[model samples]
Target: MVGVETSQHVQLSYEPAGVGDRVLAYLLDGFFMGVYFFVVFWIWGYWYSLGSDPADLSLSWVFYVVIVLPLMLYHLVSEVLWKGYSPGKKIVGIRVVKVDGSRADLSGYLIRWLFRLVEISMTSGVIAFVAVIMNGKGQRLGDMVGKTCVIKERKKAKLEDTLFKDVSEGYEPVFPQVTELNDKDIRVIQDVLDARSHYEYDTWFKMLKRTRQKLEARLGVQDHGMRTDVFLETIIKDYNAIHGSVK
Candidate 1:
């Protein structure tokens, strides 16, 4: 298990898929790719056989353009559309995530796909396996360049884990400056609140202190005899009341 520290300083435990699991996923993908290529190439061959001279076929380039190009782009396209989960990764119950616990974006997916050739294809996955084991982050060369890691998707904690309290409709917010933070910021805070059990009390203390300080500085308000935990809890409720849930 690798401990990933989210942007809010929350420690989330991730089970990095081992080299064997990765290899299995790759093989599954390869099987699909192979079957696709076989069927495509057979059709192409039949098309070619109809022409006496290969050069006479005006659509010969279609084979490369339609089949080869898509084959090469399979990983990139799948990951981007599926939000870091290719069919194989999804089946393996693993997905790519940013180190900071944010969703992996298009650029990150592209980086990983670009390096897939050398990491998995060229070296026959030896390099990727070795790198993943050594790095302990379930990362191949692509993941390193992309600044992402593959982790088993487990049951994530719900909003209830944050222990949000109910607020009356007429209740006034403590900090209007909570607007300075966005949905992502609130999510980070929620993740921090949810993941308290994963860290020591001292670590949680420092995290709460740091979060409180940042919020205070941003709001231009000094502490007004509010405990750190209470302050944070109120901030969450205020943000939710002011903006609904984080989108």
Candidate 2:
């Protein structure tokens, strides 16, 4: 629900994950941890029961190192390895990012993980729920301290703000014939592209067929083995690359 602007302040590029998504992801993570702790405890308890043996008696510290340490570090290590995605977050299609819409660094994840001990483990997520609901940006105590927020990627993004679509860097323009499209023609193309999400597959395919035919006739471009959607986006990028701004 929170908006982060896209390229050149054109429109909101990313949507913040809703509280429901956050809670579900949190529960999934907690469940995973619960399973993990149970397994580790069962194995460790069996090992510790062997403490009557002198060989096992000397390694009492092993329990703390193997079980407790990893339990404590689970979230930190998972987020670090997965680049802001714990197993649960990945399944929920959400990720943690810096507030400015960039990926968080190791230090950022560490800060958030540190706060997890208090908000989640100690108070049982009461604090985290309150903080996330009170704040409009979907930030928990950890996120606020780490300058990070969770965002969901499951929903389709709205690209209606401006005609200037953000092209990935180092994109090579394939169809030079895209230059034949005037502003109005390009606008029609953009309209078709944006409208695809609103229609079912059959209707959208028909629209794509008509648009592609029109573009091919006007610009004399072929499919080049690209899908209908791919061809359309390429020309839009080509238009951007060849012609700088929308205006």
Candidate 1 residue runs with Cα over 4 Å from true position: 1-21, 38-63, 80-83, 91-93, 97-115, 145-148, 151-185, 220-223, 238-247
For candidate 1, what is the total of clashing residue pairs? 0
Tens digits of lDDT, candidate 2, 1-247:
4444332222223568888888899889889988988997777668768665646644768767866788798888988889889888999999988887778899899999999889988999899889988987879989998999888774544543435676666777899887777666665666666655556778767777777776777777664788887888778878888777433
Q: What residue pairs clash in candidate 2, if any at all?
A: none
lDDT of 1 by residue, 1-247 (tens): 5566666555667777777777777888888889999998787679788875566544657767878888999888988898878788888888888765557898899898878888888988788888898998888788888988888887655654443445677877888878888777777676666556767888877777788887788778794689888887878888877775432
> For model 2, what is the alpha-carbon lDDT of residue 94?
93
Q: What lDDT score belongs to each candidate, Candidate 1 first?
A: 0.77, 0.76
Question: Best TM-score goes to which candidate?
Answer: 1
Q: Counting only residues 3 or more apart in sequence or on different chains, how many pairs clash (N, Cα, C under 3 Å) in candidate 2?
A: 0
